[model samples]
Target: MTAFDAAAEFDRQVRTLLDRGHPEAAGLTAAEFGALLAPLRETVTERGGAAVAVAPEEGRVPFVLVVTREVVPVERAVALTTLAGRTKPGVVDRHFADGDLIRFTPTKEVELPDAHAYVLFDVERGEEFCGAVPEDAMAAIADRGRTPLTIEEGIALVTQYPAALAKNKCFSLGGSRCGDRRVPAIWISQNAPKLGWCWAGNPHSWLGMASAAGRAAAGT
Candidate 1:
């Protein structure tokens, strides 16, 4: 899609949130806000991606749009050790340090009950985990071979395993110089680093791995 199309879609998503009684999206009606998002739309389109809007369930924070990069197959297990310096220590680190091979299997193409979630496989342990999934559903999802994940599915995966993904180096931390304090920044491009919600200065904010990966994928 073109940048303008992305921006229009983003605007529609934001409007939907507002219609759903999300107070945080009130500010989005401003013209200045639209201007600010113009470049973001362009970035997302350039990277062959789309934008997904995430709203906090608490209705406290503003609705944010995350950009999704192009979908690419990760056929082989990516060694966690390779991400040492690029990523901070986390679940992936601990597992890799223990000599475990990490595999992220996409379940987007499968017609499963919970197609929205991605399956994270610990190859050594033969264990699989998905975020916000009930214990009963895990078995069913696992039975379905991990399918290819779309950019949106990848975002959902990040949302499900924020700490684990960040620690494993799936996402990097991004920061901007906010006066004397260097505060964590949001992702705008695929080449840029990703940050968890914990780094956004407002821990309560819901901008997590999903947003970060989405931003990076969009090459903002």
Candidate 2:
């Protein structure tokens, strides 16, 4: 199929899956996911699409998916911080890992499963995406007893989610310091920021305001 044909088929297939998953999806089945996304499969035959993750035993992710401007509906856990970037380019495997959170709000016609909900990010904030109870983002994770993602992995996961995040000017949400210095440095938007790519990684970290709030709430 042509690129347009492939894209259209992919969209149709995913929508069918979502529709089936929803009560309204009357005639959808998972068996056709491959047929729906058949065009992308050409990457393997022509463009050399393959696994390139950094390490076999690195983070929780086993592989990565790179869809440009395609908002795929993953479990809300997949979304980390607000507008986290995508995975690093040409790693052993990269999805949207730019050391940022993957932000989401409400966008239509993006990815499978449908709906937006702040998927992931490269930054560290309080309990924003994790909700009242911090749960793992990937729904495929059957093992709930696994150790919480390390800061590096957490950042990696959030960064994998595609969106836009800014990192130019520091967003100071005044609070404690990084250590025992009690420094007034918490990276949150000075103004009410919606869930989107607030900044791009320059100093390699987004100072999320939620971190301070979470710290204060924890009495740390």
TM-score for each model: 0.24, 0.23
Backbone clash pairs for candidate 1 read 106-147, 172-194, 188-220, 189-219, 189-220, 190-216, 190-219
How would you encode candidate 1's per-residue C-alpha lDDT over 1-220 as one tens digit per residue?
3223434544564343233322222233444433433444444334442223322222111123422212111111111112212432112222222221111222333332222112211111011221222222223333453222233333323332222333222421221112222222122223222321122233222222222222231223
Backbone Cα, N, C clashes tallied per candidate: 7, 49
Q: What's the lDDT of the predicted structure labeled candidate 1? A: 0.27
Writing each residue's lDDT as its tens digit, candidate 2 over 1-220 gives 2222322332443443343242122222445433433444343223211121112222122222222122232222222233432222211113223432223211121122212111111123322222221222211121322122222222223334222123432222112112221112112243212222222111223332222101000011
- Sequence-dependent TM-score of model 2: 0.23
Candidate 1 lDDT at 200 equals 24
Runs in model 2 deviating more than 4 A are: 1-28, 45-63, 67-220
Worst lDDT window (10 residues) for model 1? 72-81
Best by TM-score: 1
Candidate 2: residue 50 Cα off by (Å): 8.7
Segments in model 1 whose C-alpha atoms lie over 4 Å from true places: 1-8, 17-29, 49-128, 131-219
lDDT of each: 0.27, 0.25
